[model samples]
Target: MSDQLLQLLFTGLTLGSIYSLIALALVTTFKVTGILNLAQGEFVAIGALLAISLYATGIPMFAAFILAIILVAIMGGCLERAAIHPARRASGLTLIIITLGLSISLRGLALLIWGTDTYSLPAFSQGGPLIIGGAVLNPQSFWILGLAVITLSVLYAFLGLTYAGKAVKAAVINRTAARLVGINPNTISFWAFVGSGALGAAAGIFIAPVTMSTYDMGFMLAIKGFVAAVIGGLNNIGGAVLGGLLLGVLESYSAGLISSGLKDGLAIIILLVVLMVKPHGILGLLGERKI
Candidate 1:
């Protein structure tokens, strides 16, 4: 491939990794509690904001990241209890609308508290780009990709090996059955919300320097993440990762060969076609497992 093409691909992977993290969180929440969770992006923004603020106060970057994640995770659990718990048995459409409203409300509240200015973290990684075989890669790129892989691996281990993770899987598969088996679906759902929030927060903390944090960032991130989730197959964790990487790379190529203005349109077109052709997603077959 040409130099420009190679560079774009690398750039795309970086962006795609961010999308994958966000989409994985979205999928996890949906799988466990059946909520669309429009507020997930707000979780991202909050985490980014917290990290930046704490870093400004002289806290270490690593400590800031962990604190931001913890705060968002707590908020996620609180949101589940306050907003979604009562509506768990409500229709899916209702739950979706409620979350959408919650998202809007949070966006407004963020603006009220944080104002409209954009904020960034003190550089999490050092200066300069690393060149490899005619492609330029930044430290942030590795951070995004490595974190996504590590997070996904951790998530896989949690769900595949841990008793609590299995309980969540069982709850996702069928709440009634999980309850029958002595697992409290509500407890599983609480854990799901916390895990999902932590994922979103982590993404925010990592990308804060790359994209900067603004109250409105979450709105678009949510759309992109939702698109990734649909492309990957809703509630399919592996599919979510694949979809995120695919979309990120596709957008990068499109921007390289086509117009940057058309990137969002292209993403939407891809999502629409996927929904029409294979709503089950790229790895939809995996959903056949018991929860």
Candidate 2:
């Protein structure tokens, strides 16, 4: 259709890709530990802020990004070992409260250090937009999309092929049995936390240019991601990605057709509709409903 329509669609897809990455990271942690980790948004914020600060301190950009991911991963592992494992037997409500507490604590910590200022990094590429026929696309958008695809591909390979990945999957299926088979399910849980944190941080780093970074950004982003996960079917990682993309596109189109002010509320409306109709989500077909 028109260039404006194509531009809106592309923008929606790119933003949706960011949401998908965050959702998948949340799913990875949930599958292994059964904790939704509401602190995920904080993890993304922490990664972006830390990496940006590091780069500001004269560290190379690539090195700063790598270190940010690792640091976030470490934080994830530590949180699991210190906060999650201790209350492993607690009721689901208790566990959720604990994660919420962690989210609050992390946000406070970030604000303490970062001083509540908004920040964003320069795009990895400094060149002009790539124009195609009627529409212009940013190279940064491609970078974000490419990273999402690579992350999913690598995650699939880890969960489906490698021995460590298989062990993690087995742990998810049957923790006791996995332990009996010489797989340390607890260790796998820790790894899941690390992986999830790293992925979340990477999303934060890449998308910082598009969205202003604030201590509270994580909480907001996490809420949208939670809706996406619920709509996609929490247990299905693939569905998480699809649901995120769908939500993003819906929001984008709604903004184009309606009002920008209603875009955020529209996500909630879509979530309500999905829950009312299918509560379990698109991938709920797998088995054992937890959504």
Clashing pairs in 2: none
Number of the top TM-score candidate:
1
What are the per-residue Cα lDDT tens digits for candidate 2 across 75-165? 9889989998889888888988999999999999999999889988888889999887688888888888888788778877988899888
- Report backbone clashes per prediction: 0, 0
lDDT of each: 0.83, 0.84
User: For model 2, what is the error of residue 112's alpha carbon versus the real structure, in angstroms, after optimal superposition?
Assistant: 0.2
lDDT of 1 by residue, 1-291 (tens): 687788898888888888888998898788777788899899888888878888888978888888889998998899889888899889999999988888888788889978999997755578798888878778788887788778778887998899998888777667678899899878888898898789988888878878879987887777788889888888577778778888999999998888899888887898899899988786765554222
Model 1 spans > 4 angstroms off = 284-291
